[model samples]
Every structure is written in structure tokens, then in C-alpha cells.
Target: MTRLVAANRVISTDGKEIKPGVVELDGERVVNVSALLGERPFTEWLGGTINLQYYADEQLCAYKDGKML
Candidate 1:
């Protein structure tokens, strides 16, 4: 199954803070990390995954089908 992790801020492996980034995952594997400049909303990066973890303001929140899990 595919999973997604979106955060208002992501601390990169290189020790950089990626503000408002999105990470894509496939099962237990990471597929992509997006922190580009765009006109996209958080909903746009959202995929059809029942398992999603979102972090905002240093708080971790999980969502299942758009509802808190």
C-alpha cells in the first residue's frame, strides 16, 4: 500500500528544514520528497492512501480517509 507524509516543516537528512514538504512512500519504502516552489495546496499532494501521517507545529497527526485516526 502507498503512504504519504506531509508536514509543515521537515528536517532534511542534510540538516535543512524543508518547510511545507511532502514525502511519498510505498509500503515501507520512501519514494519521493517534494519541497518545491509551487501553487499547490496540501490537499493536492494528498494521495489515495488510508495511511497518512501529517505533522504541523511540531505535532504529529495521523489521518485515515481525511479523518483523524
Candidate 2:
């Protein structure tokens, strides 16, 4: 199924903080992503993160191993 994820913050692999963003997922794969209000580019900002954490509406979700956590 497809879902929309809203992230408040993300910690990159290089230990950088990524601003909030919205990610569109099909099951566990990222189909599209964009930064939230007052944030940077999602693709560029999430470049080094092992795990992507975001909010699916109100619930917190993690993306890893091609699946949602």
C-alpha cells in the first residue's frame, strides 16, 4: 500500500541533522519525497542516513531494509 510520511527530523549517517520532510512510500520503498515546511531538500538531506524515521500522519515510522518500522 502507499502511504505518506511526515518527518520531524532525521539524523544522517555523517551525524548531521536533516530537517522535516514528507516521504511517499509504496509499502517500504520510497516513491517520492519532499521537505516539509521550512526544510531543505529531502533527497539531499537524507543521503547518508541508514534509517529514515518519519511520521505517518500521527504515528512514528522508520524505514529500513525496504520496509516500514
What are the RMSD figures for all models against the true structure? 8.9, 10.0
| Deviation from native of the Cα of residue 30 in model 2, angstroms | 0.6
Using TM-score as the measure, which candidate wins?
A: 1
What is the C-alpha local distance difference test score of each model?
0.51, 0.51
Candidate 1, 1-69: lDDT as tens digits: 555566565444445666676665554444566674555443345433333344455434444365653
In candidate 1, how many Å is residue 31 off? 1.1
Question: Least lDDT summed over 10 consecutive residues: which range in candidate 2?
Answer: 41-50
Please give the RMSD of candidate 2 to the true structure.
Answer: 10.0
**Candidate 1 global lDDT:** 0.51
Which residue pairs of candidate 2 clash? none
Q: What digit string (tens of lDDT, one per residue) describes model 2 on residues 4-58?
A: 6555554433455556756666765555555567543332333323345545564
Residue 15 miss distance in model 1 (angstroms) = 0.5
